[model samples]
Target: MQEISYPEKIDPRLHIYPSQEADRLKSRLLEHHETGILDAIGRELFTRMDTAGLVPIFVLRGGLALKDAYVEAAGFGPAGVIVPWRARHTEDPTVSYASLPVVPGARYALVDTLIASGRTIIACLQALRVRVPGARVDVVAPFLATAGRERVIADAADTHIHCVWHAEDVDGDGRMVGPGFDVGDLVLGWQGRHLVWSGERGERA
Candidate 1:
């Protein structure tokens, strides 16, 4: 539970809770297998959001676990679409799925577990923009890297970004600092690529 200082030019659209509070909640989430604590965190985030007529858009794999908690906490139904994305050293980041027709100028909450380099989220945003011009998007996650936050803010200045904790830049070893674990793998049980299961015979084309 540490205090995080922000620069004078920090974007007004970026919202985050205190690290101490986030740490407490995150620990409970891990201990309880991401059930109650996830809902609690979601409630905290959704209460601050203007959720009326909002559409929830979950990113696949990593975001799958968050869907139920987020929807229940927000008092909404299931997401209409899940965007499958991949961002790895072996391939350029991409959003592989096309969503159902989007409503122009509608509000969307793009849910993901973590934002490390922001490449995946950025790629998702690009696809969303193409489908729903002038749509208002809010990038929601539990943990986010400082660099990733900055990158999203720079790329989508009007988008609102919300997270429980802010992590330091990715380390040289490619570890995300604050969370201290691979959230995707932890939530999903096993992971290779988002599109491919660990024990699968081969990656999907």
Candidate 2:
């Protein structure tokens, strides 16, 4: 990777679970995906949506990851629409999400590969709310940090956060962990690349 450059100010909420634990968790995350653990998690998320009258909308993030494959095997359905969100820049880092049809008072599952700082997830959820008022949001990721979950909840009280691996599961030296070492890099390396399903199953891709 690109030498793992980091921003000047690190978020205070970041954590490093411990070296041994971090290594173990990292290995297990890969193992889970290969062993269909992530698939089960995705199915469970879908089940939750069915019960709550929500729909799944996978976020096509900018990173070069196999998120599309993971979501596809889990049965999310080719890449279609893009939900734009403002990334954290040194200057104004206001977050946003693309406008989409919102079922009145319904739930929407915002799926992504991982959540490091939760900045992007928070931005997307908040913007989504603005576009579709009164809709509940569920943030799903295969891996994420505890701080990310807390931040999402803090930013959107009605948002439900779920993940396979928490940041507390990994080891880091505070500022040097999580995004510092490129936590999602492994997904990028996973070989089963596939087109991310856009919109609903029958929707155009």
Whole-model lDDT, candidate 2? Answer: 0.47
Q: Model 1 TM-score?
A: 0.76
Clash totals, every prediction: 0, 6
Query: Where's the lowest-lDDT run of ten residues in candidate 2?
Result: 1-10
User: What would the per-residue lDDT of candidate 1 be over residues 35-95, giving only the tens digit for each residue?
Assistant: 4565566656566566677778877656766776666667754355555544344353666
Residue pairs in collision within model 1: none
TM-scores of all candidate predictions against the true structure: 0.76, 0.52
Number of clashing residue pairs, candidate 1: 0
- What TM-score, to 2 decimals, does candidate 2 have? 0.52
- Residue-level lDDT tens digits of model 2 in 1-205: 1121122223332221222333343455444434233344444333333333545565645222334434554444322223543322222224333534545565676777566566666767766666667777676665665566567657777766654345433233222233333333334444443343323322211
Clashing pairs in 2: 18-171, 22-171, 78-196, 78-197, 79-196, 145-167
